[model samples]
Target: MRSEPTDAERALWKLLRAKRFSGYKFKRQVPIDRYIVDFICFNHRLIIEADGSQHAENAYDEARDSYLSQQNFRMLRFWNNDILTNTEGVSEAIWTALQDETSTPSPQPLSRKGRGALEGAHNG
Candidate 1:
């Protein structure tokens, strides 16, 4: 990860930091496995990414997302432009995702080995 955050990341961090967002704790530039996520809320198993044009249809990101999903992390990706311009809408979307718990299980950390074993058993 870069030492300096982009303008958009800085803006979003203001909204998410210090449990300011409805008491949900979020960490920035967090490492999960081999990938460094932009923002993450461990309590919700949620990962939020602020993407630039380079990330459009990115194969590496797709693969990374798949891997994280298998580990029970939900992804919410927003464009830098959108995050900067439509800040309220972006915040609303994140709030909706956080409140909608029916689709996701209670937050729990799963080790890589445990996730692989579960997938193997399911496939077998």
Candidate 2:
């Protein structure tokens, strides 16, 4: 539960929450340790960050991105204005990135079932 992200983050959240895009579940304001990310899809180890001008001066953010990359997470960052105005293009870019089979990161998130938890899901 993130303190409701910025306007730009909210806009993208609307498009990502509830598996709305390509049926992937993206969590908002997820805290991996001390930092909270705008969106994280653990299934694909994909992180979507919508950055504002302040991010330009945040050296800490750069360090975080590098750490995430080293942890096998693919970080996709979009400028706030770009995401707010060109949602379709943003979505397309995400789709295209996901479809890059040759460069797709491996060791995908394991299924809950593999760990003996069924997510309390009831099958019909």
Candidate 3:
């Protein structure tokens, strides 16, 4: 994404995109506005940013995070070293975050009724 993802990011991508964690599709170098997210899963409205060391002291990063937050996009960041060094853990973390809350209602199902039937949520 950013000038050929850093080593850690590259390694993490190897594991993340392998379908080890099924149902999660991650795109590299996805352009969102002026910023290009390292990975994004639209179904979950999640953006994953692989931070190289420069992020810790970056004021711009804070503002950027704030703006993304306001836009209702959840940002998940992983340090290059951590992701590269501990890919299994990273995968676990990503999967955990991706899980939908069971307490919340799942999407309503579509009705199979004829045209005469009223359109209503066929919530399962």
Candidate 4:
């Protein structure tokens, strides 16, 4: 997938790659559970998908997103056309989402120390 990215994917990759977007590292063609996502920021548990016309309101996409959501991963879908034509807007939207400043706060990572303390308290 890395070698043969769509025009839109290639364009977006430029912005997402090398931790250029707010210093968050994004991996391409990452396998999360059973699904392969276009771009994923592991630290944020965010998945970015670039889809073509066929994917508009696609049932498969919906199901896939549902599954990802259940697994505590946030999904963002963009039309291929939008990525190609409105690269800046797409990048800005992604940046905003990453910042967790949107209406819905993005998932924040749980610290291991906190998790362990909570677990110990519950067990006690």
- lDDT of candidate 4 over 90-121, digit per residue (tens): 77667756776223323232222322112211
Worst 10 residues of 4 by lDDT: 115-124
Among the numbered candidates, top lDDT falls to 1
**Number of the top TM-score candidate:** 1
- What does candidate 2's lDDT look like per residue over 10-116, in tens digits? 89989998989989889888888766778888877777777666665466876777667677777667777767777777787677656653353332222323210
Candidate 3 residue lDDT tens string, 1-124: 4586688777767766745458577777788776777777777777766666566546676666666656666766666666666666667666755784222222222222311011211111
TM-score of each: 0.82, 0.76, 0.73, 0.77
lDDT (Cα atoms) of all candidates against the true structure? 0.73, 0.66, 0.59, 0.66
User: Backbone clashes in each candidate structure, one number apiece?
Assistant: 0, 0, 0, 0
Task: Sort every candidate by TM-score, greatest first.
Answer: 1, 4, 2, 3
The clash tally of candidate 1 reads 0
TM-score of 4: 0.77
Q: Write candidate 1's Cα lDDT for 21-67 as tens digits.
A: 99999999999989999999998888887777676556787778878
Candidate 1 regions with alpha-carbon error over 4 angstroms? 104-124
lDDT of 2 at 104: 39
TM-score of 3: 0.73
Clashing residue pairs in candidate 3, if any? Answer: none
Q: Between the candidate structures 2 and 4, which one is better when assessed by lDDT?
A: 4
